[model samples]
Target: MSSPQSRFYAARLAGTPVFDPIGESLGKIRDVVVLPQARAAARAVGFVVEVPGKKRVFLPATRVTSIMPGQVISSGVMNVRRFEKRSGEQLAIGDLLERTVTLLDGSGRATVQDVGLEQNRHHDWMVTKLYLRRIRSGSGLSKLVSRGQTLTVDQSGVKGLFGTDTEQSAALLLASYQDLKPADLADIVQELDAKRRIELAEELPDDRLADVLEELPEDTRVEVLTGLDSSRAADVLDEMDPDDAADLVQELPEQVAEQLLGLMEPEEAEDVRRLMAYDEYTAGGMMTTEPLITAPETPVAHCLAMISREEFSPSLAATVHVCRSPLETPTGKLLGIVHFQHLLRERPDRPVGEILDADRHTVEPNMPLSGVTREMATYNLVSIPVVDEDGRLLGAVTVDDVLDHVLPDDWREQDEPPATTGQIDLSEIARGIHDGDTGSEPAGTAASTTTRREGGRG
Candidate 1:
C-alpha cells in the first residue's frame, strides 16, 4: 500500500467526501485520523466520515489513493470493527457520554443524561445516575404515574450498560465534578503519548471523541491527530470551530501545514487561510472566524435558536454574540452581544433586542493606540469591538491582544528598562563615591580598594 504523503493534514478538512477504494460512496468526511506515537510525529493515516443513513465509519490512511481539491479516493479494503472499543486518549467524554454505577436502591443502572453536569457544569456526573424509564402511558390517568414498581432496565445490567466493565461497589466514590473538569481531563489526556491518544480515540465513539478533543492544547491535539494519521486528523479538525481549526494549522510546520491543506474542502481551507494571514497581535490578528453572525433582519428568536444548538463554542458560553451580513455594506457591523448570564436573568423567550445595550461603546479600525488605551482604561473593557468607518465590525481587541502590541512579548524587559540611548552615566564616577546615591556610606578611595580612613594611609 502506498503511503499518503505527510502533508496530507496541513489544514483542517471539512465537508470533504469519502469513498471506498473501488470509488463507492461512504460518507462526508467529519475528521481526519492519525496514528499516535511517543515523541515523533503521529503519522497522518485516516478519516472519520459521517455517513448518510449509516453509522460513521473510519477510513484508513493506507487505503487513500489520492487527496485532491475536493475529494478523498480510497480502496474499500480496511476493516473498522477493531476501532469500536478503542479510545485514542483519556478524555472526559466518557463521563459525559455515559457511565454505569449502582444506584442508591442497589439495583445496577446506567445514567442517561447526567443531570449533575447539566445543573453544575463542573459536576462529576458519576455520582448522580439518571436511568432510562420506559413511557407506559396508555390506559388510565393513574397508569401514567408508576406505583414506582416498573423499572426500565437496560437490556444489560449496569456493567452491560457501560459495555465491558462490571458495576463497582455502591460505596466506591464517584469522581467528583470538580475533579472531572475538562481542563483537568485535557491535562491528563495530553500526558499520554501520541500512540496512547490514537489508541484511546480509536476505541472511543467518533462523535464523543470529537467533543472531548475540542478542549485539548494545540501541540497535544496535533499529536493525537498525527497518531491517528493525516486523513483522520483532517476530518476531526473539520468538525472543530474554524478559529480553533486555524489555530491548530498555524502551529504546525509549514511543510506539514501545506500537505494537510490539500486534503480539506476548498472553502473551509480558504477560511482558515484568511484567519492565519493576520498577525497574532493586531486587531486583524487574534480575531476569531467563529463570530456569531446574523443578518440585519434575522428574527431574534430565530438567531437564538441557532446559538443554542452548540454551533458556538460552549467554552465561550457566556459571550455568545452575533454579527451583520456582508451585503449590508458595513463589512463587520455589530448586531449585538449577549451575555447568557444576563440573558438568563431575563426570560429566555424575550426578543434579543429587548435586552441589547444599544449604546454599548465600540472602537474603529484606524483608532490610534493612545485613544484605545485610554478607552480601555476608562471602560475597563475585557474586549473592545474594532470596527471600520461605516460602523462595520471587523474584529474584537482583547486585553491580551492590546498588551501584545503595547508590550511586545519577545522584547520585554527583565529587571531594568530598555536604555534610552546607549549613553553611559559618566557624572557618577567623576563626582566621586561620596556624592553617589549611597549617601550614608563613606566613600571608598581608589588606591587601597577603599582608602584606610580618607587619607590616613595610601
Candidate 2:
C-alpha cells in the first residue's frame, strides 16, 4: 500500500476496495490472514476479500501491486474459491483484536485495540505493532473516575497474544462480524478449525446458529449441532425451518434424532416429523412449511406486511398463498396466490382474493423433484404451493430449495485445489514483461503501471 504512513492498522483496512491489474473492481478487504511467529513479527499471508455474492476469497500479499488511498490494486490473478483458514493462520480482526495480553514492562494487562502491519525492506508485510487499551480495575467512584490508557507498543514487548492457547473472547469478534450475512458468517465458521468453530458456535444464539446451519455444508453443521448440548441443539433445531430441520434430523442417527425431536416443542416436532416422512427428493421434502399464507379475505396491506418480515426468504416473500379460514400450513384449501407485484399495485384496502394471479399452478406434496422443477419452470414461478389430497396447502417449494437439491452435494465446499506453477521461473517472466512495458512507456507512466512484485522479494 502506498501510504504516507509507514504502517497500516487492521481496522482502517477493513472495507477498503480492492481492484485488479487493469483497475476493474475486484472486491473489498475483509480481514488480514497472519501467521503468528513465536519470536519475530507475525507474517501476513494474504487478505480475505469479499467478492461479489458475499463470497470471501484469499488475495495473497504478493499479488498486491499498489495500495493507494481508499483502495488496493492486485495482479489480476487470484483464486476465486472460498478462503479457508489454514492451521497456523489467524484472522487479524476475527481472532486477534480485542484479545487480552500482558505488557512486558510489568505495568498491567491490556486489551488489543488494533494490529498494525508494515512492509519490510524485502516488501513482505508483517504485524509489528499493537494498539492497546490498558485494562482498569476498581469499583464505584474509583471505577467511574478511572479510564483505560490506550497506547501503541512493539509486538515484541507483549506476551500471550499469539498461539492457539491464547485467551480470546468471541464477543468482540462476533460484534465485528454481526453485519455479515448468514452465508458469509457460515463461511467464516466453516473455515475455522474444530476448536475455534465450537467456541464460536457456543457464543452464537440459537436463532443465529440456526440460520448459519442452513447455509453451512451438511457435515459441518451436523458437527456443530452435535457439538452443542442436547437441550441447546434441540432449541437450535426448533429455530430452523421445518424442512431444513427434517433434513438435519435425518442425517443424525435415528436414536439421536428421536431424542432431539422429543425435546422440541410438540408443534414444531410434528412439522419436522411430517416433512421427514416424505422422500428426500420429493416436493414435500424440499418445501418450507413457513411460506407467507393468509385468508382469502385478508387485506392487501396485511398480506404485504406478512411478506415484509425479515425472516422470510426472497422467494417466499415474492408471493402470498391465499387459503380458506385457517392461515397456518397445511392451511385450509388453497384458494389461489397473490404476487407481491399485484399486491403493490392494488389499493391497500382491497382484499388479496381480488388480486390473485390467474393461471395458477400448484404441486402435490408427493410430486417428484423433477416434476416440481418442471412445473415451476413452466409457470416461471419463484415458489409453487404444495397441497395434499384435499387440496390443503402443505407448504411451498421455493427456487432456492430446488437449486440446493439439484446441485452437487459438495457444492458448499468451495476450497479449490492450490494453484500449480511449472518449472519455468514465473518471477523471470514477470520481470521480462514489466521490462518490455517500461521500455514502451512515456516518461513516468511506467511507474503507475508497474507491478509491485517486480524488483522485490520473490
1-458 in candidate 2: lDDT tens per residue? 45534578887899999998777999999999888776678888788899888888778888887666788888887776566676667789888888888899987788888999998888888899999998886788766655667899999988888755564677776777898889879878877777778888899998999999999888998899889899999999999999999999999988999999999999999999999999988999999998888887889889889888988889889989889978888789998998899889999999888877888898898887777876776667789999999989999999889777765576566344223354423233234333542122112211122322232212
lDDT of 1 by residue, 287-325 (tens): 544545555454555555665875444433334445655
Q: Which residue pairs show collisions in model 2?
A: 1-67
TM-score of 2: 0.81
| TM-scores, each model vs. reference | 0.41, 0.81
Taken over the whole model, the C-alpha lDDT of each candidate is: 0.48, 0.82
Tell me model 1's lDDT, rounded to 2 decimals.
0.48
Residue 13's lDDT in candidate 2: 92
Highest-scoring model, lDDT: 2
How far does residue 9 in candidate 1 sit from its true spot (Å)?
43
